[model samples]
Target: MDSSPDMGLFGPESVTWKVHSEPIVTMGGLRSLYLQALHPRAVAAIAQNSGYKSDPWGRFNRTSEYVGTVLYGSTDEVERIASRIRRMHSRMTATDPRTGERFRIDEPELLRWVHVAEVESFLSTARRAGLKLTDAEVDTYYTEQLKAAELVGLDPATVPGTAAEVAAYYERMRPQLGITREAAETALFLTVPPLPDFWGNRALRLSLNFGPARWAYFGVAGTAVALLPPWARKMYGGLGLPTTDLSADLSVRGMRLLLAGLLAAAPEQYKMAPMRRAALERAGLA
Candidate 1:
C-alpha cells in the first residue's frame, strides 16, 4: 500500500518521490513526471536528441521540443518522433540518485508516469491554446482517462475516483505541498521563463511525449481555481494567474515556473506542504 518511489534529484537522502491518497496531481499533469523518474529520463532524452549537456535549461528545452513534436505533429510524425524517445529511454539504465540502484527505462512505474504525463501535456496544452471544458466535463474526462490508465496497466488503486478526492489525496500524501511550492518558486526565480513565441502556433499540436503528471496537475489546479470561493478566484485572477489560462500552450519550463510562482506567492491558497517530503521519502528522498 505504500507506493512511494525514491527521487533523489539533489542527492541521496535529499529528494524522493512522494505518494498520496491519489496520484500526484498537476494543473497540466506532467509535473508528476518531472518530479520523479522522468526527470532523469527527460535529461537522457535531451542528451540523445541534441547531444547537449543536461543543464536545467537544456533539459527543459528538450522537454518542450519533444512535447511539441509529439503533440503538435501529425499522428504519423508524432509516432515517428515518439519512436526516438522510446529508443532513447530503452537504452537508458539509470541509478537511483539516492540508492544507486539501477532501473530499466521502461519499468511499469516509469512508463505509467510517462503515459500520464503525455496525456496531461496534450490536454493542458490544448486547453491553453483554446480548448474548453467544464468541471463536470473534466471530471467525466478524468473518469474515462482513469479507465484508460487502468487498461494500460496503471494499478487500479492508483487512480482517483473524484476531483475533490484527488485534492484530498495530494493533501494527505505530502502535507508539504505548500513548502514544495516555495521551493518550486525559488527554482523558477532562478530560471528564466521560456520565451512566449518559442511554442508559437505549435500549442495547437498534440505530442506523444506529454507527461501525465503535468496533465493531472493542470486538471487539479484548474478545478481548484474554478471551485475556489469567488473572492479567492478574483484575487488570483487579479494576480493574472487564472487557472483557466495558466496552462495554455505553456512550454514545459514555463508551466513549471508558473506553477511555482503561484505556489510561492500564495502557498496557503494551494495548501502546499510536507506531502511531497513524505512521498519523496518513501521514494527514498530522505
Candidate 2:
C-alpha cells in the first residue's frame, strides 16, 4: 500500500475507475455530503473547520481531486495528499452541539462514518442512475476502497469493506445520528448555491445564472437528497415515499444519460479530472 504502480491505487481495469468515470457520480458526491451531514458532529466539524459557506465549490473541487488522486495518481502523489489530510485533520477540532463537548475532527468513529457514507452513496447513486453494476461488483468496489479509508488513517478492518458490512454499520449508527440546525442549514445552502462563473467568462456566467439554471441546480440537489435512505430522508422532513424514490430514479437516469451524451462530445480537458486525464494520456486514450 505504500507504493502504487503506474495506474495508481485502482487502475483502469478496476471497478473504482469504471464507477467514478461517470457523470452521475457528481450527484453521488452531493448525496454523500447530505448523508454525512446527518451526523450532527460530522456536519458541525465541516461547518466549523472549512469555508464551505464562502467557497462551497472550492471545497467540493478539493474533495473531488483528493478522490481522483487516490484512485489515479501515482504512489507519491497519493501518499503526499493523504499525509497532508492526516496532518490537517490532526489539528482541527469540532464540538458536539448536543453535549457541548469538543472533539478532534479525525476521531476514528467520525472518519468511519464519513467513509461509509461516501462509499454507500457513490455505489447506490450509480446503481440508481442505471449503471449495470452487479452485487458482486458492488462488493468489489467496497473492498477496493478499503485503501481509501487506510489513507485517511483508519485501519481497514475497522471500516466496512463489503456491502453487508456497510448496511450493518449504518444500522448500528442510525440511533446516534440526528438532524441538527447546522445540518438543515447546510442542506438548504447546498440546494440553492449560486452558479459559479466559468473560466472567467463573465458573459457566460451571467447567461447561466438565470432562474431556470438555479432551479435546475435545485433539481439536481433535490434528486441527490432523494437518494438518501428512507429513514435519513424522513429525518430531513422529506417525504420518504415510493413515488418520490421512483421520481428520483427517473430523474437521475435521465440526467445521467443526457450528461453522458454531452460529455462524449466535450473536449478532453473538459471531461475529466487532471489525475484521470493524466492516466488516460498515459494509456493513449486522451
All candidates' TM-scores? 0.37, 0.93
**Residue range 1-286, candidate 1, lDDT tens digits:** 8454422222122101111111223333333333322234433332333332225456656665554343223335445656666677677675544345767765665555545444544344434433445666545544544533543345756765445645554345332122123223322322222323333355532331255534653554454334332332343332335553443334433544556576667755354434344433454533
What are the lDDT scores of the predictions, listed in order? 0.41, 0.88
For each of the candidates, the C-alpha root-mean-square deviation to the true structure, in angstroms, is 18.2, 2.7
Off by over 4 Å in 2: 1-5, 197-210, 283-286
- Candidate 1 segments exceeding 4 Å error: 1-61, 114-132, 140-286
Clashes of 1: 60
lDDT per residue as tens, model 2, 1-286: 7343376687777899889887688899899999999999999999999998888888878888888889888778899999999999999998998899999999999999999999889889989999999889999999999999999999999999889999999999999998999999888888877566453487766766675776788889989999999889999999889998999999999999999899889997787777788987766667
Worst 10 residues of 1 by lDDT: 14-23
Best by lDDT: 2
